[model samples]
Target: MTSWLKAAAFGVGGIAVAGLATLVAFQERLVYVPVLPGLPRAYPVTPSRFEIDYEDVWLRSSDGVRLHAWFLKHSPPVAGPTILFFQENAGNIGHRLDFVRMMMQRLHCNVFMLSYRGYGASDGHPSQPGITIDAQAALDHLSERGDVDTSRIVVFGRSLGGAVGSVLAFNNPDKVSALILENTFTSILDMTGVMLPFLRFFIGGSASNGPKILNFLVRSPWSTVDVVGKIKQPILFLSGLQDELVPPLHMRLLYEKAAEKNTKCLFVGFPDGMHMDTWYSGGDRYWRTVQLFLEQNVPRMIDGKLSSKDEDEDDGRDCLQRL
Candidate 1:
């Protein structure tokens, strides 16, 4: 074959390779994705000790997938904010005890730290719809509190949990007291740029191929962009400046798109911290910030529709000092 023909063939093969890579990475079993074993023994997670008390909570999704979680209700009722925490992408609620202990004791709020489908003993698999269903189930469980105030409930998430957080905030802003996202990204496209690098360019480079084909061929179920603007509740975003995993710039870009500036929304950054360790590594300042945020926005129980998105009426967080 002539050199021109050979070059053309090679170019076609490369496109084929790239296309195949995109399809497989996106469509692969998300079930196995959650099942990745603990990190290599040589580089295991070194967790420090903290006093975290525990309790087992079971929730069945609307679809009947039984999920597991830890309900660390505050001891003897200090009565601050009740937080429904979505864990980072990982094993189970057990790993988050140190942080939970600090929040429960320090933040003075009851914390329910829960896992998605397959992470812990939860039945079924992890996927976009599945996790959303799982979250709704847990939210329903929280709604059933007799002594617990539903209006003062807070929703917090980190990393993949942020996507979970966004979904909850978007669909049922009324159920959430306030929304807190840590180390989250703008969208799955942004995440892919961070994870795969430069492929976002090609996704739009030749759009004459049409949006439907582009949509079908594209990978990633983690799109938070649409949900980002939909969330109308008070929001606080915590990002690490030096984070390479999710990148602070992504979160910053997201903060810009939020609908209202008056929703008690603010983006806080740690100039010296990394991805996951921002809170723990920042020490006293971190817990103080977390506690103050809950207190400032969530407020003590006022006894009337605490978490809903009522435009005319305002809560303690909104009307705290102003009113």
Candidate 2:
């Protein structure tokens, strides 16, 4: 009996070690789910379907990887703000047409939707650093366009894109006038804890060292919380209280961190919304809040000089209080 028990113990230990090894080896696969290039019927909708004028733009990342994007111009060509939109980790830029159309028609802002490297028809693989480069390239493309009002650029991102946008805004404070993040996490590490509470055992306690061991293996530690405090640009944090993936606490923490330096921070919570449903759930209120933020932050240039003094006169606390 004792010999049999010893053999079983050895087998269990071997399996655990094998499992840990496999996890560490391919952890990137678990984080990034790139849809790959050349999938038939990948994009179900296009701007032309809605009668929106758009240009299929091809950009090159700083690392020389060619990226795909869509520059959807607002109708009537008003000198309004241009939104550099970074989408969630899943799906290509073509998958988000409904939201894009809503933003263009409601906010009346030019939208530039970028497909991260490896997703959609873009070249190369997707990584935290790689996508960040893609974002910078998209921003550069928009900035050079004569039709785009470069001074009134807004960086809007949702979910994983939020981290990308925040980092870009922090790096280019002079270029990004305002930022909007929806259903974003504080950090991938923090989110890991939330997703796998059992991992806490690795840090300390009696749960087992599995989580602690795996934590060190995460390569893409996109810690948005660390960078939020450094951003001085006006920010709007939209949270879905019922978000199952990221949770509302993450958004609140991000809002608190940004508020430390950015007195222009605004947070709007949607009671009936899930992770991706905040925009639709909030309805007209969502667009109204976004419009208010744009009106206050996106500078109005009369003759190469900022003409709007509304942002200077009022802090964003009143706006948050009303929400």
Candidate 3:
């Protein structure tokens, strides 16, 4: 009976080791999900479908990896601020056209969104280092374009993309006018505990208790908290309190960190908003908050001097244009 019990325990231990090994081996697959089951590698639709004018942009990263993006100009182009959008993981920029259309129509800004390497028609597999290069490449491409209003580029990111935007803004403070993040976590190491509570024993007690085996194995740390304090640009945090994937506490933590380091940080929370539906659930308050933030922060060239748009004009539009 003792021998049988020993064998059973050994078997369980071996299985547990195998599971950990598998997680370490293919963690990138778990993090950067470019496509869902039955979702095509090819884009389902284009910006033209919504009667919006756009240009398909092809860029090569610093490491020579090819990337894809869409540049949607506001009417007359370069007249207003340009929003450099960073999308959440799990889908290509193709899936975000409706949201893009809504933003362009309401905000009256030029929009540029990139497909990080491995996603959409871009080349190479997705990783933290590679995606970071891709974001830089997108910015470089915009800088080269004479038609883009480079002076007023606002970096907007959601979830995983928020981490990406944070890193970019930290690295290039002069290039980015303002930063906006939505439903972003502090770090993937912190997120590991949130998603798989059982793994907490392996990760440790605090979020920054580093050098643990599980933390070492994380290929893409994407630690937004580490970089948020380093960014000098004005930051607007849109937090969905009801987010299921990434807890609302993550955004609050990020805001606190950013506020401590940078004076110009604002956080807006939506009580009923979920992980992906905050823009819709937030309603007119959401649009007004965003519009007001932009009006105050993002600047435009009036004649030869830099100036912000007037904030006294109220648009008074609801969130009927749900994406």
**Considering every candidate listed, which one attains the maximal lDDT?**
3
- Could you give me the TM-score of model 2 versus the true structure? 0.86
Root-mean-square deviation of every model: 6.1, 4.2, 4.0
The predicted structure with the larger TM-score, 1 or 3, is 3
Output the lDDT of residue 208, model 2. 23
Deviation from native of the Cα of residue 249 in model 2, angstroms: 0.7
Cα deviation in Å at residue 204, candidate 3?
A: 6.6
Question: Which is the winner by lDDT between candidate 2 and candidate 3?
Answer: 3
**Candidate 3 colliding pairs:** none
Q: Model 1: per-residue lDDT, tens digit, 106-151?
A: 7887887666887656777677788888888888888897756788
Residues 1-323, candidate 3: write the lDDT tens digits: 69989999989788668767876887788789998778788888888888878899999899999889999877655476888999999888889998888888778899998999999999999999999989999988887788877888889999999999999998888899999999998988788777656465565323445445677777888889889988899998999999999989889989998899798888889899899889888887777788777876775678978664346744322221121
Cand. 3 TM to true fold: 0.90
TM-score top scorer: 3
Give candidate 1 misplaced runs (Cα > 4 Å). Answer: 1-19, 22-33, 36-51, 204-213, 218-220, 259-262, 302-323
Which 10 residues in a row give candidate 1 its minimum summed lDDT? 40-49
Question: What tens digits encode model 2's per-residue C-alpha lDDT throughout 214-322?
Answer: 5566677678888888999999999999998987988898999889887888888889889988899999888878887787778578887766555465554455467
Output the better candidate (1/3) by lDDT: 3
